[model samples]
Target: MARPVPVNLALRDRRIDIFFAVVFSAFTVTSIISDLLPTVGVDFSQPSDNFFVQSNYWYAHDADPLFMNPPDWMRIITGLSAFVYMPFYIVLVYALLAARNWIQLPSVIYATMISSLTGIVVFGVEFFGEPEFRTQNAVKFLLFNLPYVLVPLVLLVRMRKPLPFTRRF
Candidate 1:
């Protein structure tokens, strides 16, 4: 007798996973393209000259030579690179986590999610901060390429099990 067909749930899940992988890859490709392009060097002016900050070492010192009281959001965005690598570090930790079980899949997914969130927050901060400090290209790099890194990890994990039709081919 023929074996019973796999449940639709598994099929649906697989399809969604594949879709995510493709989307992630597309984002990575586009981000690379945008990064390669030359900056237009267009200048945009900001409204305020000074910034307001709480009592912190960096805050105590002049954050920007031009803007005495740059907005809090601007300060964070200007320094976003400090946090951008955290997601990548998480991915490596998850790689170790993967060795314990199939936990890598979730870890990879979470890494992507975290990276996306980081990108969004950075973008918002930059937008609200100084007009000259805008860096959408940096945000694009993180959002697009970060997810693609997980796709290969997932594919390798899934290849262990063969489908029923594979024997006939």
Candidate 2:
């Protein structure tokens, strides 16, 4: 077996990876605040009763009313984000910081899942949902949620090669 050569990846030059690390770290927190909270029984049905949702304009805006109504499928995805994806976001924060290559498969999976969930399921609910379920602020909703799709897609492409951290965009 041939030994793989170690690439000297300078963190100073890896600005984008650092951005990804910060974003994933932020996601780690949001997974808890946004997704995990809902899964753990903090009701989103009435933002008036939910402290975070009530206090935060992002949630209170009702941009994505799915949070307010949260059907079974939405609950499932929130549970998934809380239990599965939240952990990944934590690991991803560390992985991106350390430039670890092993995160490729898991990140790809995360990207695909997030893209499909937000890109298809979420947007579908927001755009095509019954009037009651649709967002009152479609632009704001899309602006806030777009990163969930765009960032993962960027990471998906970033991880396409071996030693992904060594590669620069």
Candidate 3:
């Protein structure tokens, strides 16, 4: 009889998971507070159809995008920050599901795939296009991104498992 192959739990590298958690936490929170925070004063009262269109125009031209627009470099940094949120959330939720004594591996994998794809799209837009509608976009981005930070923190606090160790320490 052929020997059975051993399953690789090495795929579950706890060190990397913890590292991701830390890095993602830092990136997401910074994006939310430092970059997007200032956007609170952005003008969003333009005509409905012109909102996003105007924002992107300014983004493309490297001009002041709105009433309280920051410099282009700042916008780039903030936009890029939005990209990492979904993957962070995905990994966090997957971690929770996996650590739960009940959920199956297939379900965890499915959740990860979905969240990873979401992160890709979020990042892809920032990569290929500049958002024109400054205030609306910033608000929507924050709404989507904040949960990633909160869910993981809450889970890490409540879960019994030692945080998946990372290379940080």
Which numbered prediction scores highest in lDDT against the true structure? 2
lDDT of 2 by residue, 86-132 (tens): 88888888888887788989989999999998899989988897777
lDDT of each: 0.36, 0.80, 0.42
What's each prediction's TM-score?
Answer: 0.30, 0.89, 0.29
For candidate 1, the 10 contiguous residues with the lowest summed lDDT are: 35-44
Compared to the true structure, candidate 2 yields what TM-score?
0.89
In model 1, which runs have C-alpha deviations exceeding 4 angstroms? Answer: 1-13, 38-121, 133-169
Of 2 and 3, the candidate ahead on TM-score is 2
lDDT of 3 by residue, 1-169 (tens): 9967433233255444455456555655555554443333343334335545444344323423332344454445444444444344455545533443232343344335434433454334433446652344555454645454444444343332323222111
Q: What's the candidate order when arranged by decreasing TM-score?
A: 2, 1, 3
RMSD of each candidate?
A: 13.8, 2.1, 12.7
> Best by TM-score, which number?
2
Candidate 2: residue pairs that collide: none
